[model samples]
Target chain A: MPEKSKSSPQAIGYLYGRRTRIFSLLGLGIILILIIGIATSIGSVPIPLGTTAGILVDKLPFVEITPTWQDATATIVLDIRLPRIILAGLVGAALAVAGATYQGLFRNPLADPYLIGVAQGASLGAVIGFLLPAAWNLSGMGVIPVFAFIGAIAATVVVYFLSRVGKTLPVTTLILAGVALSALLGSIVSYLVISSGSKLHSIVFWMMGSFSGSAWSEVFLVLPYIAVGIAVIVIFARLLNVMQLDEEQAQQLGVNVEKFKIILLAAATLITAASVAFVGTIGFVGIIIPHAVRLIWGADHRFLLPLSILTGAIFMILTDLVSRTVLAPTEIPIGVITAICGAPFFLYLLRRRKRAIF
Target chain B: MIELEMRNVTLGYDHHPVMEDVTFKASPGEVVGLIGPNGSGKSTIIRALSHLIRRKSGVITVGGRDIEKIKRQELACLLGVVPQLPLLPSTFTAFEIVLMGRNPHLGLFEAESRRDFEITRQAMARTGTGKLANRHVNELSGGEIQCLLIARVLVQETQAILLDEPTANLDIGRQEDILDLIKNLCRENNLTVLAAIHDLNLAAQYCDRLILINDKHIHAQGTPAEVITNANISRVYGAENCVFTHPVNGLPTVLLSALKKKEIGRNTISQR
Candidate 1:
């Protein structure tokens, strides 16, 4: 008897050009836009959706819309809310993509962006920057973000060196080294926090992660690094999929296992460090957003990477919106909002699926 | 088709040699089965052969060129492997997993083309896994995943194939089906094939030749009749196993001897 693929047309859809996958991505793109609009419209002054659309449309080069809104509202929308939202989206995207990358690289579903001590190192760097002389601020760039980036890179380098036995960097060794370093750096950060006299409040707030004073300059600063990192990762998406298998299998299929792991680990860490530099140490987004995206779309990293970006952005924007509005003039740390909101929703997804998210 | 040759190869982990000076060759259009005991380095041999492990003391070559001199991408195009019990991401559909076989053929920046998809579809169909295309890998049984792995290697289009415990997780009937598929493909395509199979009988039946590994080396190598003798089986496996002639094919078949079945009276041993 001849063996033929007589599976239904839907099965062919899975094997071939993924039409539905593309359409769904386009749909998510629209959802991202709507979320951006909503995030911008519903601030303290409460700009209407129509006015928000008009103000946004006027900014487009080819198209001009009459600015019926007041200059105050325009300033509030573009300068304040827009940049803040954009920064949140960027941080969210960076963490989510990095988280997904780490999860794939480690071949463990529990792996998160912060698994390798990026958050602890960045936080320690920020605290040291705070404790140092104010003259360390360079070129109007805040000392904390720069120091945080350096700290993150330094911490990862140490971990990498510590874990490497030879040419190969085993994933388990890297993870163990990271956990050990995180504990050390975390203690130093806490000790510094207790000793700091006046800057205690600011340091604690930064540790909790906030988008309170985001500016267009900060958004533009991190955007290039985050974009480049995510692009490099997406380019390796196919190889990353192969890496879901064990190292031996991956190498048998022609991937240079050690080199590929290093490249991805570097890319993920770079984005993660950049995100943490400006955003303090936001947690949960790195772990939860990937799960959320995997819950809806399958775990193909090609889609998973890009969709995680969009889903992460929308989720953070919404979470930040709640962080500001729920307290009504009193600001809460974005990290707190994420934990409160993300945990239950993540639990809901886990319970509903009742199986592996990876 | 490519020739896979291992000359005095010694493989190990962390400077500890697991297998020493192992030499074997699998020619095109031939299936060579590696038979050994539980810890006799069967998997280690496959790993070294595929260049997945560094050989401490000797050379392994593909098509007359040293594998160490070959670039990873080129090597991948020449050899494909089906490893034992590889973990697949739970959410990846079977088609997507099979589609990954095209990675070596694709450029770094290139996405999977339509032709790649067609090849994957055909491979899955041939492996009798077409219905599994839309199903997630997590939902599949171990046997089904093993079959899917075979399909992946088929789409890989390598001149040489290495299989590590290919039938370890399969049922009885599927075992024959997989071996038959491998044998037919090897002959049809004139591909060099090497499989590490635990079942001495199946290995003896399907393989053109058998290499018995013991004490971290090739203990015996020849035609199945020569390699699967009762003396060799007992020596390598440390068991008084019997090798019977297959009535239909006139090949050697191994049957493990029972450990002298004695009727156990419930109270026979020192009952008060």
Candidate 2:
């Protein structure tokens, strides 16, 4: 039997205390709003912080603030900066939550949204769409994201089936299968990218990832997919918690393991595909944001999902701001910024913690 | 109260058959011990009963309803299972793991209520796991994890419980405490329990009936005194001289002795 620690029960009560969770969630909410406002104010044409708030309030339904800011400032805040920030936030939230879900599903802390080749598949699809005849272009920004979503889902389905031996999904086998497939698909994408003569610059830029050309149209296009996917995941958060146990134990506890796995995989993949399709592939946000949240709060998905959503959004908005302003006129790829900032912090977390969290 | 019955259940993995034409019945308020050699499909039988795996043929029913026909949530309410080696997430606290037993009773969007917390706390208290509620499952010892699993099943509040070698990692005193607690719950709540146990003495002491499996079939089954005999033990387990009746209860008991050189050599040759 385990040795009884007199302090453990009290420690547990504190760790899972309801009030602490509520307060932390509330704090994150405030931080997200602050980051959005601050990020909106930091672009090339620096809009005053108060004017950024005023412009946002003016757009609200009933509340109309007198236009104190110039039309150019308003355009910068509302049209260009606001859409980019919101898209970045949405994609970040989507990737982080998807990452958390994948980590839980695979029972591996290293599992990320891109672990199963979603990014590579989406990249291939987007490249194909770009290489298609110009006559097929229906809108200014068209076909790429739709095709990307399809390719991501198709790749995930293929990986899932290939990894299954009978009814069991061994984690090691799944990761290996995903890695192998990702390498294959990535080569195909590289081959396609090389053959595209004049479109090399655009395709490479897309692959490197950025929120540069983000528009309200792109946001509207991805909204429904991300919204529905997140809603489904949030609804099944507790089931995800139960799924932390082995498949057999979860099944015995009345979770329809196979069905639940399918539903969660689909939802997570949908959001991830949508997030990556427009912004290319932002790496690290999905993996790091969730881990950062787990470090602060506990691993309860009920809290983890929502907290990850907020933290990811905040992190992405700040990273995007850094990408744009750090080197003026020439913007660094958002992926590079995320990697540079995230990798060192992740290493620090690894060095600081002694026990395995997962 | 629920009565569990399996009729000619054939269980296996893939196409390879392990246990064939197995049949058993345990009425409400009875504890049935499934005792067998390792690899004899004791855990497979429990898995089949829990619907973790499908039986190749025949029907397994609880309270006269086919387990296959029942919905997952409904079946979970009817029977709770304690797997021999459960893989739990290292980060989850014992309280959170125990609280998951309320999953079947909850709807898709429902959160645990105060009553659910009360029941889970009561289960932890009953299993003497209240002190360890804050600890991570990965940090816990094997015996503590076993007790935590039992607490989880108790919170499940099923009419029947199935345990797969539930006391394998526990000390002698802890083993008795857990078995006695299960036995008391069986008698008081009219719960049917089917446990796969390796320890024959504990089986004879706690189980109302015992099923001895040998060579993929039920070799002998009855009250402990009837099923555990010198001839049966010698044939099924190859322990001829070790089988003896208990002094106080008159039930069969196994006493181990150092094997003679010839006997050890013969057993080693046969194993090879």
Candidate 3:
């Protein structure tokens, strides 16, 4: 009889644990749909929430749409809102996924997509593109993004090599080196901003981050990278968990640690480069979203990586909506909104999981 | 009967040799303890044998197959290890941590099978950690965490186990518990165990044979009673100690030789 009671508690505990995981995933899914719908409904001319869903349904294959092609509702949904919403979702997912990958690759919870100074480097390049006299003529020609992508790659490479003193790169020292590089690059970017006084506003806006400039072209450009990056991360997720043990253990477990590190870091860097090229330096999404997901879901990378992507997409769309509608005609930079939202959450996470901060 | 053999093995880092000409063998159902003074290359020997670090020149063979010829996973399947003060990833639950033992068995891109879970569960039960299955490993006490690590190795289901100071950091009770667990597991499973133990008495009590290392060389190798002697202890460890038998088990034990009574200081007398 006593044994039965003891086993009963064990069985009940197992069931409860499984139930919570399911509930969390279901909750994230529901929030994602709601955020996408609400974000699509927001803008200068607010569309009804129902119309947003109807528009999405109309675009789906098997749904019969009797609405005329020339209808104002159809045009607003298909041409404008659809692309913007899709862009927001993709960028958010990309940033979040990139953040998760970097965190795992570094094996540091505090690490994010911005850890290797990629975002700062990309921001510097964007500033250079904006401040240059030729930028006025080169605007909308994809020059800014090209420069930004190059800057990100260069900065990450520098961080990578500088951190490798010999055969072994201690994680703490690597982080410190990355922080130093970020500061140096940041100062150089600030100098560029000050030197080009007339173009300072444009440069600052780009640095602050924004999705206001997102168009179908930028979205399409980033989509391939995001898809590829996510696929690479998903494929390597279990291998990353293996690496959480010492390198020797990971090797014994059939992971090529050096090869995996190179591939994972490259994929993460590619995602960040593609993302910042289009949306500027949107802070907090990449860093905070993955950690938040981890806090709730635990560290099964199989679940954490995909969940982070979904949550990140939803988070960005919601933040972008707030950025656009907060001040009717003039939009606040999406970076500002994300920072203002993310800093508090970061502090809360740090406070709640003080031991995990390190 | 020799399952694993290391012959004239040399190991070091970056062309600098730490230990050389180290040779040993552990046959099936035998417990061999490697005992040495600090820096005598006990860990270096284990690392070389496990292929965690490369050996400069030696022939290491498992089941008549050369160690170098075996793939990493295949080797892992042949031997499981319990490292000294293993640093574990904190985020995983006890079950998840144990389930990783199946990595050698898992196909790339394939999930763990139900059989894997059953094995993990049985390991946890054997280690008396089934109650903590759902708990995060980071939250466990040192003793509990050590058991979970042992459980992980058990789930690996290797024919041999290599333990490096597995109980070095535990309290006396926990150390005894872990040692007993390892001894029983090896006995029941007929496992070949090569353990690096610092406590000479514990090694004397449990090991079927002892290999004493001093200055990167084997000082003595035989039964505990044969290898652990006043002459060998004073020579190898540079310590003056007396040998005695355990009261219950009648195993050889050591006591440090005391100085003459006249040499005792007046301050020591006053303190006593």
Q: What ranges in model 1 sit over 4 Å off?
A: A5-17, B239-241, B258-272
Q: Model 2, A105-214: lDDT tens per residue?
A: 88888899998989889988989989999899857778887777777877888898999988767667777888989999999999999999999898888887899979
Give the count of colliding residue pairs in each prediction. Answer: 0, 0, 0
Candidate 3 C-alpha lDDT tens digits along A83-123: 77788888888889988887887778778888888988897
The C-alpha TM-scores of every prediction are: 0.94, 0.95, 0.90
| lDDT scores of the candidates, listed in order | 0.88, 0.88, 0.79
lDDT of 1 by residue, B124-207 (tens): 888888878888899999999999999999999999999999999998989988989999999999999999999988998999
TM-score of chain A taken by itself, candidate 1: 0.96
TM-score, prediction 3: 0.90
Error of 3 at B168 (Å): 2.3
TM-score of chain A of each: 0.96, 0.92, 0.87
Candidate number of the best DockQ? 1
Candidate 1: deviation at residue B18, Å? Answer: 2.2
- Model 2, runs deviating above 4 Å: A1-16, A161-174, B259-262, B265-272
Could you arrange the candidates by DockQ from highest to lowest? Answer: 1, 2, 3
- The superposed Cα distance between candidate 1 and the true structure at residue A125, in angstroms, equals 0.8
